[model samples]
Target: MNSVRRHALTGFAGLALVYLLLPIAVVILFSFNDPVGRFNYTWAGFTLDHWLNPLAVPGLGEAMRASIEIAFLSSLTATLLGTPIALALVRYAFRGRGTTNLFIFLPLTTPEVVLGASLLTLFLNLGVSTGFWTIVLAHIMFNVSFVVVTVRARLVGFDRHLEEAAMDLGANGWTTFTRVTLPLIAPGILAGALLAFALSIDDFVITLFTAGAQTTFPLWVYGASRIGVPPE
Candidate 1:
């Protein structure tokens, strides 16, 4: 009976995972297939043309470049800003720390439309230009929580002994952090940054709201869909 139950659970889990990943598999597969139309994919044979043919879609290259730049900048910014907050949450006890942590994660749990609108309003009030800069900032704001949460998990396993040893040897906090703590947690930070980058690059709703005159990849894809897609 136990063996049967175990097999049943495993089967269910496997099916669920496959169901989730099917769309992603289709996207990756379709991204390679360059065809003659959009609705019905004509097999012009398998080619990497869509991925490589920058000028094929006209402005596709520019959109890709913008998305990459924004993703990189925002992820890096989020990592820098999030690490300290994560460290503080992990290592220090402070009043309102729980509240701070809650706020950090609140944006992630909030509706994307609401957060995007709020960011738009904030940018408008500040008279900030809402192009690349606004997109970067908006991405960072939404993605920082992911970095903090990911890094803080790593922080739990971290040994503060190295930091303390550096301090004992007369190193200042900044130096100790730079020389000791930062290096140890670098992997977690990097992973978190990659995750943030993925989120930023794939985002459409928030980017749409915040980007006044800029086009990220998702935005470009969306707009292009509206006008009409050319070859697949």
Candidate 2:
């Protein structure tokens, strides 16, 4: 009976994996298809043209460049703001620590639409125009929480003795931080940075609200879908 149950669970897991991967599989399969018309939804014939010249689609290259730039800038800003907060929360004791954590986590739990709308209201109230800078601010605001959490997770299991020993050995705060602390928490920083970049690049709802005249890759793709996404 136990063996049979185990087999059943394994079969279910396999089905779940296939269900999650089916769309990705379809996308990969259709990338090779050369549709005769604008809509590439229906497979016409297989060709290497799309793969060879990805920029064949008008405005795709520009949209992609915009996404890359925003992702990099937002991720960098989040990392810079969040790393110190994570280190402070984990390594030091302070007043209103619980409150700080709650505020940091609030954005993660808030609906994307709600967050976007709130930011829009905020910018309008402050008389700040919505554009590239507004989008950058919004992305950084949402991403900082994730960066803090990811970096904090890595710091949880870290050994404090190493930092203490370095300090005791006549190493100044700057030297210890640069030589020991930064290197030890490097993995968490990297993970947080990558996560921020991915979220910033793929974000649509927030970008929709915050971006006034600028169009990112996801926004361009969404608009193109109404007509028919150009095969590239």
Candidate 3:
């Protein structure tokens, strides 16, 4: 009976994995497909033209470059800003600390549409024009919460005695942090930054609202979908 149940669970898990991965597998297979026309949805043939000339798609390279720039900037800014906030929350006891922690999650919980609308309103009120900077700022705003959360989770279980030991050995505060604390928390910080980058690159609703004329890669792909998406 136990063997039967184990087999059933294994089968179910395998099915779940396939369900999640089937579309990705199809996409990977079609990456090499040579479409007969503009739309690359249906498989026509297999060719290396798309791979050989990646820049064949008009505006695709520019859009991808813009997306990478924005994602990198936003992730870096969020990581820099959030690391301190996470450290403060974890290492210090201050007034309104609990409230601060709670508010950090508000952005995560709020609907993207509402956040976009609110940011648009704020930018309008401030007489700030929506453009690349606005998109970067919006991405940073959204990404910070995730960065803080990820880093904080890592910091929660960290041992403080290591820091004490470093200090006892004549290491200054800055040296202790740069050499010891930062290294220990590096993995979490990296995880958070990667998450920020992914979210920033994939963002659409907020980018749509905040971007005046600049198009990120995802936005470009979305616009291209109205006509036909090039394989590249």
* Candidate that would win on lDDT: 3
**Under the 3 Å rule for N, CA and C atoms, how many clashes does model 2 have?**
0
In candidate 3, list every pair of residues with a backbone clash. none
TM-score of every prediction relative to native = 0.81, 0.91, 0.92
The regions of model 2 sitting more than 4 angstroms off are 1-16
Q: Which pairs of residues collide in model 1?
A: none
Per-candidate total of colliding backbone pairs = 0, 0, 0
- Candidate that beats the other on lDDT, 1 or 2, i.e. the better one: 2
Instruction: State, as a TM-score between 0 and 1, how close model 3 is to the true structure.
Output: 0.92
Taking the tens digit of each residue's C-alpha lDDT, what string does model 2 give over 1-232? 9999999999999999999999989988888988877787998988888888888678888888888999999999999999999999998999999999999999999999999999999999999999888999999999999999999999998998998999999999999999998999999999999999999999999999999988899999999999887666
C-alpha RMSD between model 1 and the true structure: 3.2
lDDT of 3: 0.94
